[model samples]
Target: MTRYRPPQPQSSPYISKPGYKALNEELKGLWKTRREVTAALSAAAAEGDRSENAEYIYRKKQLREIDRRIRYLQKRLDVLIIVDKPPTNQQQVFFGAWVELEDEEGNSVAYRIVGPDEFNVEKNWISMDSPVARALMKKSLDDEVSVQRPAGPIHYIITGIHYTED
Candidate 1:
């Protein structure tokens, strides 16, 4: 028997316009790949015994994974709200805003608050549900915010907030 586990909290149903388009393209690509895999499986099945055909087994597994991802993307895309425009109140931090923060030690860092689907650490894009993003939400320039992290509490001052790319 499998161990019992609680259901996870639902992620925010928000995505950037580019993210939405990328997901749609991925779904389409997966469909094409699935068709190719199905054809390969058929060819492999005709060549040997069902139980001993490694090529058939691999193709079947690949097709199953592709189908699973296609299902997930279809469901996720249906509910995502694309945020293509900046919020009316640009003075405060909001979704898709690029925020610059300064720590007590005078170090500075910047991050863009984006949907969970598009958060990329390499680009300094943070998910809206993250602790830092949550603390900065609705905060204005010069405002001090504290975030409770696993390492402990950290304070930051909002140095800049911009809705457009810089």
Candidate 2:
């Protein structure tokens, strides 16, 4: 059987070059998370001896996790390439392009295609590797496309597309 270890948190990215600067910014934010966790740990430790201090142990665990993430981000930031602009062509879908879709039922949904690192489903963002994105790639506005999902093949029409920094 596979071990119970959880998957490491994914890096946030939107381009192939890798976003070093953004990763640095993310590491900086994580440092703040570490600092807050450390303070909590100290406060917990100061309450009493170590044996029965659940708060101390809990906070220490939290701090350790935070530090692990911080260290990874620090190392990862060194390898990413920052992408600050879009491609010259705007007529076709490309990475970072916001695509609005409508199903045959006429329900509309919009999503921004980003690198594997920056997929936020709730915000209507998808990884460029996603099937829908794959099917939509190189398709012009108003093009019709279909994706074969587990639920069955779903068809959509590209209603609109735009490239804007939101």
Looking at model 1, residue 28 earns an lDDT score of 97
What is the alpha-carbon lDDT for the whole of candidate 1? 0.93
Misplaced by over 4 Å in model 2 are 4-23, 39-43, 46-48
List the pairs of residues colliding in candidate 2.
12-117, 13-117, 18-81
Tens-digit lDDT track of model 1 for 58-133: 9999999999999999999999999999999999999999999999999999999999988999999999989899
Report the number of the highest-lDDT candidate: 1
What lDDT would each prediction earn against the true structure? 0.93, 0.80
Return the clash pairs for model 1, or none: none
Task: lDDT for model 2, please.
Answer: 0.80
What does the lDDT read for residue 16 in candidate 2? 42
What TM-score does structure 1 among the candidates reach? 0.92
Q: Backbone clashes per model, in order? A: 0, 3
